[model samples]
Target: DPPNAHIEVSDDGQGIADQRVDGRYGLAIMAERAERIRGRLEIRPRHPHGTTVAVVLGPAGRRDSV
Candidate 1:
């Protein structure tokens, strides 16, 4: 089996929208950093409220492994 690593953060405040996120440079920077490390960055609204931010990577030291 391969090594898997992920970091997740959740908030209880109002969720963010795509339109609102467009003006936020921090999110873009985070997404770019994740891509450079072969990781996936996800930002989505949580159930009913709040938001979730996650960075998931597969296979340690394996950048090509998605």
Candidate 2:
């Protein structure tokens, strides 16, 4: 895998409310997926307005051939 990879998903229309940031199921799902893949997910406020979600997938370990 690459050293770093960023994925941004956002919308300007009615950005996520601060209260819902931690209550959203989607966000939780994202986190779970990241953990399953040995990666991490970060979420932060975007410039002006909106939320930014970034996911980084680290390199996979090499397996020894039998």
Candidate 3:
């Protein structure tokens, strides 16, 4: 809606706290890519389980939704 788009993924594992979480380049790379396309990336821990990764890009691309 509103010329915006959202992409999301989630898991049911132990989440970010239990993992080493440091010296990891995956998330960094993802975030950089998002910024390059004028988007935002988010990471959040699930209440009872894993993690959620989301990307939102908006106001600058094709608005048609299929």
> Which 10-residue span in candidate 2 carries the lowest summed lDDT?
57-66
Error of 2 at 31 (Å): 0.2
Cα lDDT, model 3, residue 60: 86
Q: List TM-scores for all candidates, in order.
A: 0.75, 0.61, 0.75
Give per-residue CA lDDT, model 3, range 1-66, as digits (tens). Answer: 563788999999888764556788888898988887878799999879899999888888544442
Candidate 3 least-lDDT 10 residues = 57-66
Error of 1 at 58 (Å): 1.3
Sort by lDDT, top down from the best: 3, 1, 2
Model 3 ranges with Cα > 4 A deviation: 1-3, 18-22, 61-66
For model 1, what is the error of residue 34's alpha carbon versus the real structure, in angstroms, after optimal superposition? 0.5
| Global CA lDDT computed for model 3 | 0.80
* Model 2 steric clash pairs: none
lDDT of 3 at 52: 95
Per-residue CA lDDT of model 2 for 1-66, tens digit only, reads 483445667655545666765455987888977777666788877778777777766666222221
Distance from true position, residue 50, model 3, in Å? 0.5
